[model samples]
Target chain A: MKVLVADDEPQIRRALKVGLERHGYKVVEAADGEEALDVFAEQSPNVVILDLAMPRLDGLGVCRELRGWSQVPIIILSVRGRDDDKIGALDLGADDYLTKPFSIEELLARMRAVLRRVEAGQASEPTAVTVGELTIDFARRTVTRGGTELHLTPLEFDILRYLALNPDRVLTHRQLLTRVWGDEYAEDSHTLRVHISNLRAKIEPDPMRPRYLRTEPRVGYRFLSGRS
Target chain B: MPTTRCVYSYAVALAGVAAMTAALAALESVRHIANDSMLYLLVVIGVAVRYGSGPSVAASIASFLAFDWFFVQPHHGFTVSDPAEWLALVLFLCTAITVGQLTAMLRSRAEEAGQREMEAAALAEASWSVASQLDLDHALRVVLDRVVQISGAGDATLLGEKAGAHQVLAQVGDALDPAEHGLLVLPLGAGERIGYLVLRLPPGRELSMAERRAVNSLALHAGVVLERDRLMRVEAQTQALHEADRLKTALLSMVSHDFRSPLAAIKASAGSLMAPGEPLDEDTQSELLSGIITAVDRLNRMVENVLALSRLEAGAWRPMVEPTPVEEVVASALEPLSAESSARVEVSLEPGLGEVPVDPVQMAQVLYNLVENALRYSPPRAPVEVRAWRGYGSFVFEVADRGPGLPLGSETHLFEPFWRGPGLGESARAGVGLGLALCRGLVEAHGGEITALRRQGGGTVFRVELRREVGR
Candidate 1:
């Protein structure tokens, strides 16, 4: 994955470039707002990391400029961890943001998430399906293992269908609740986890070490298919 | 020679009187040989004109003797032969004396009246000096000057009471030590002195009566001016205090409103985020973070604006003005926010535009705030324009965007603190608006003005104008 980091402070730019590149993404750097624009135009990076403060241009200005022509996923790095800024950036078309002094692990995770969403939009076919110790029929919603039938609840079926629909994509707990249980249940991570545990118990050969459903710590859960 | 000349003039007068008496005696001798009245009446009129009232009585008695000897009955014998002639002689002498004295008194009274008229004219001309000057200080100076001219004192100073102590207010010529110039204090009570008069220590024994009266009059007039001036000052101070009180009330309400809105948003957003699940997808998690950052940015700008106000009051910060480039300024202000917003920012500096004279750091701050303000208002899908151009000998940097135009009347009040417009309050993602106020301060520090204009079709434009630094 290609990522762009825009920051006026060389230290922050250098640090983010090192951290993001260490996560196996190709990194391009801009020292100031002017260079950030030039670099963005040249590189067409898959993901852009920006600082709110910069010399030639600010992160907000850069965000605004990029949003005009492109719907590319953008992540803002802000020291100001206020709701207004988040809303401002999101409303302006930024994909996500990371406040300064963030853990490198979190940055890598967000980077992964945005790329997955971008990649998901262009994906064409449903790849594969598996249940218990058997292959499944995706079009007809049936699963068998060892030549025996497996019973799945209607709610469980719906959850499996969503997971399969967004295979290898990290879905935050809130996203999962909203998509599956509706908007009112978006905040109920406990409910989401219980449902996920139940789904794993029914579908996984070893529920403790699930192969399909992966837990992304401190952020969300992801569904990784056999292709990975 | 002096004795002969005195005698000759008196002798000439005596000769004319004696001749008149002889002629009257001849006429009376023809008409009535015993009448002496005509001769006596002639002598009385002559004495009134010649000697005045006191000397005139002596002249009248002498004339009576002349008449008895020359013009009475039994001429040239000093006796009137008839009893009727003797009675006439005595009556004529008494009437002559009284008439002479009355005529002399009237002439002298007319002369005394003329002298009094001259004194009134001199006094009127002197007091004219006081009436012409209106300023209290000027008037007092004129009064003192007139006193010096009128009373012939060599020098003058007007001393006034301020807070119950005397201070020399206005002086003309050889300013005197309070102790040196023999001062006459007349404190203006209902009937007392509230002021003092100083006069030159004239090389003389003591003050004349006229000098004392002139000093007393000056003190009375000065007290009127001093009291009037004091009253006017008190009234001015009261008016200023009332205006300050009004401003304070306005400030308090605005501060309350400004602080409450963003704080509410922050609290509400935090409350929402506290729930266990990420209600918004991975994308929405990012959205929530962006909102929080925006709110915090608003709060920071507000705090900076308030701090700037306090600093202005205490004179803690004074701008060190110099020439600065617009492009550089834009970069410095935006550098931090670009990363924070995660948005693309566009910056274009007008070519051939000269540097503006301003404090470099403050100019940067001004640019930062305007860009930030525009960013908050504009859509993230739109490119925020930070454009600098030269117009009419002034350099202007404008942060323009395709956002909702400023609310009615808000274009003018936009730079006022806490002025969240209808456009801002309408936004679910709005912030407390102190950014514009801080921009105003930074611009004004460089002797320029900042204005927010609603663009013709759509969008808000913040225009900052600065005078170009000369010869650069």
Candidate 2:
């Protein structure tokens, strides 16, 4: 797999290159957003790790340009407290984001998750999926926890199914609303919150410490399964 | 006529002459009227006193005609039969005309004097209004209302131009229509047109010279008031900028020391580990690696605190409040601590205590900062307690530590930015003193309050109380 790392700081890029190369992955580097796009077109890397602040063009601009013609998974690297920019990148179709000062292990985990999602998209659909003690049957349209059926409203089931299909990926409120309730209800996050709380109560063993469904806070929700 | 006063004055002149003639005729039937033409002169003087020159002259001419035609020898005719009587009648006419002209002149002089006095009073009142009221809207309204009252305008509006858009600063009575014929637009300010006064007078009515002058002075006063307001705003802005500059300088000096120390340690440790000449032992290498990690963690914490402080000062961070469980907040707060540190800390929440409305992310940061402070101050292996409960009409939480109590008279000073406790030697655990300040900012942004008090027996307790229903 080839990974494109675009950041203005030379130390961060060098550190990432060494870390990924030691993990046996081919690493391509770019210093800014424009070069990032150029390298992305030339090398056609499998995944791109883009930084938010750069000279010439910023990360959001690059994310928008790449998403215009490419579906290659992109993860945004942003500084803490830039919640608006992170959400903007996510809304512009970036796959995921990691706040700055993150460890190499965390970055590798994000990369692997996005790659797994892409592969899942290309593969044939599965009839049933299981993560931990929770099992969902797409064909049967039912959810079971440890071999016993858990009752769910139709709307709750639909929300769960959509999240399950895109596990370990941060889905924005607009994306989820547009998919489940159609475009007319795309901005009704309050309604989405009510349904999510109900769904969490039924599925998670302890709603306080969620094991499957995780909230990204001010962004959206992420469904975490046992595997990457 | 340009004014209704002109038309009313002409009608009064005609009516006065006719009334006097009728009275003379009625008196002649009752008794012998000696010099009855004198009654006509009375009418002429009355008209001259009330109305000015033109109507008084008309009254004089009308009185002469009526007296000669009604009471002379040849009745209903302008001729006088007897020469002495005719001379007497002609003399009466001359006396009436001269007296009417003199009285009209005196009346006008008095009217002008009254007008000047009224104009002075109006100007003084407007000046006082502008000077007394610091509120620009009220002052402008007073000036506009005075303009309308003195100028006899049906309505008045003060239109100010700001950034190429016209705004109605103050309006009195009805709105002035631009299409109205009697609209008077007076531009304000001495050099540039800062604003304008639009007045709508009654149809066919125009302002007298004195009224116009008074209105102009009032408009000028409004302009001065606006200029003064602008100057005040600029002064306030400059003061705020200067204060912010001072804070930034202080922050920079303090941050540089904190940042460089950690950076220097990390650089030295990394450099020694990467050096080629000497191979270090395994234990020494491990120690160096751990040292580097510790330095990086300190730098990261400092960076977070600084970013949070700056964002708070800039008013960029607003709490996105939602209903959040207390357990979740506590869990997230503890998530960042090392396993050993987390085990040392004890968490006790009120059973059945449900959710509270707050920004979970920010609330967690507040709890984390407090808990971290408590853990840092307490002796090694001494338990730091985190408690949450429902207070009276509020949600309250406290972080208690069994360590050294707060310094005397330093309870409030503990929340000021860059305030470090004295007597602590330079060590790896020392903070940049921004954590508590950031906690206060975050809590207050949610319309909540945070306080620190010496614990009853041993240590200190940092308490935070948030409104149950955040009015956002």
Candidate 3:
């Protein structure tokens, strides 16, 4: 996979390039937003990570222009963790949003998640994912626990499918809201929590002390198979 | 039609004639002609001093005619008895007229002196009034009012450039119609037409010498005051710009120091781990990896906090407040801190506590700062307590820690940026002191209040009060 990292800070670009290259992906670096667009046209990377604040043609402007011609996965790197900046970037057709000072590991996980969704959508072929006692059949659109059928509401099924497909990776509340409930519900984390709690109650042996579905504190939810 | 004083002077002249005739008749036995003539001269001089030049001159002429008819020889006839009497009459008329003219001149000089003194005093008063007013707007108004009053004009106004356009600054009496009426525009400042004082005097009426002097002096005073006002405004603008520049520099330095330190550490550690020659032990590798993680974590927190502070400073943070449960927000804020610090705090919220109207994310930041501050200050073993309840129609959240209490009288300065308490050393107070200041900004932006106070028994208590109802 080819990834483009655009940031004004030399150290951030250097670090991202080293880390992404070490992970066996071809990496291209841009020092500014204008350069980022030029590199995107020339290199045609599979994914792009953009820093929101840049000299000339900031991340939002680039995201907007790039979305007009291409549907490439774009992840916004913002120092501002406020919901407004995230929503603005997402509304402008960014695929994901990550706050700054994030580790290479977290960035890699986010990029993988976004790439998987894009690839899966393009392939259109469904697959089943099994983690611990829970089995999610994407073709049948059903979830079962330990060979026994477990009925779930459609919303709950969608949430479980998203979580099971990206197991062991953390998802932000905004990311899940945009994916599951649509873009208009991007600012509401309360609804997401309620749905997640309802889903956990039906699946987990003890809802109070969940073993498979885990909350990453203020961030979001992650599904652990509990095998590790 | 004669003036009343002129008629009175004529009567006095006739009276003098009658009195002299009666005196001559009574003193017919001993008559000295020169002495009797001197009595008529006394009447002319008295009238000249009493009445003014016009009445005095009339008295002098009348006395001359009466003396020619009655005192001179050949009184019953139309001719003088002798040419010598003609000379005596001419001398007497000249003496009376000259004496009347001198007396009139002396009276006018005294009156002019008094009038000049009054004008000077008025000018002094105007200067004092203008000088005393420090406020530019009020000073301009007072100056316009004085200009109109002293000049006896129908009205007065001041015009100056404000915000790149010429507009009326102050006016008194009727609103000035510059197009309709003639105006006396006195330009303020050195020849540059920075401002103008305009007066509208009635047609056919002009300022007298004294009034003119007073008006001119008042205009000068007004000009000085207007110039002072302009300078003051420029000074204020320059000061504001200077402050903004200073803040930008401070922010730049702060960002450079805070961001680079952690990046350097993380970079060094990451480089060492990935170095080819480092075939290090497992323990050393894990330690290096963990070090990189910690540095990254610190960088993340600092980055997030600084961004939040900048947004708040820029007045760009518009929170979307809703009725939210306080416990959920607190739990979310505490989630990331609990495991890392190993200082778990369980807040016992009051049952049936009403929902607080707040922005969920910002409120989380507020709670996070308070909780993290509590954790940082207290001993690792001491439990941090969070208590919540509704009081006085507002939701209150208190974070109390069993740490050394804040220095006395630091409550006021506690929420100020870069303010660290006296007891904490450099290492103890990690992270820039933006946590509490950011908390205060976010809280206030939400129409809530945050305060730090010394706890009753020991330690410090941070209390945040959120209004029950949300307002836009």
Pick by TM-score: which candidate is best?
2
Choose 1 or 3, whichever is better by DockQ: 3
List, in the given order, the native-contact fraction of each candidate. 0.00, 0.24, 0.10
Query: RMSD to the native, candidate 2?
Result: 6.0
By lDDT, rank the candidates, best first. Answer: 2, 3, 1
TM-score of each: 0.41, 0.78, 0.58
How does model 2 score by TM-score? 0.78
Candidate order by DockQ, decreasing, is: 2, 3, 1
> What TM-score would chain B of candidate 2 score versus the native chain B?
0.73
**Local accuracy of candidate 1 as per-residue lDDT tens digits, B1-472:** 2455445545544664577676776786678644445555555566556545655665566677787776655767786799987787788777877787786677566644553443344345435644665567776776676567655667667777778787787776766666763544344434544566676645543444555555556556666667767787999789868855654664676556666677787777777777776465676666776777677766665666666654543445556664544433554466456454525466677665545666655676777777766776787667777788888878888888778777778777777655555645534345435566667866776678899888877998889887765332
Instruction: Give me the candidate number with maximum lDDT.
Output: 2
Top of the candidates by DockQ: 2
Looking at model 3, the pairs that clash are: none
lDDT of 3 by residue, A6-112 (tens): 99999998989899999999999898889999999999999999998889888888999899999998988886454556566776778767776677887988888
Winner on DockQ between 2 and 3 is 2
Worst 10 residues of 2 chain B by lDDT: B423-432
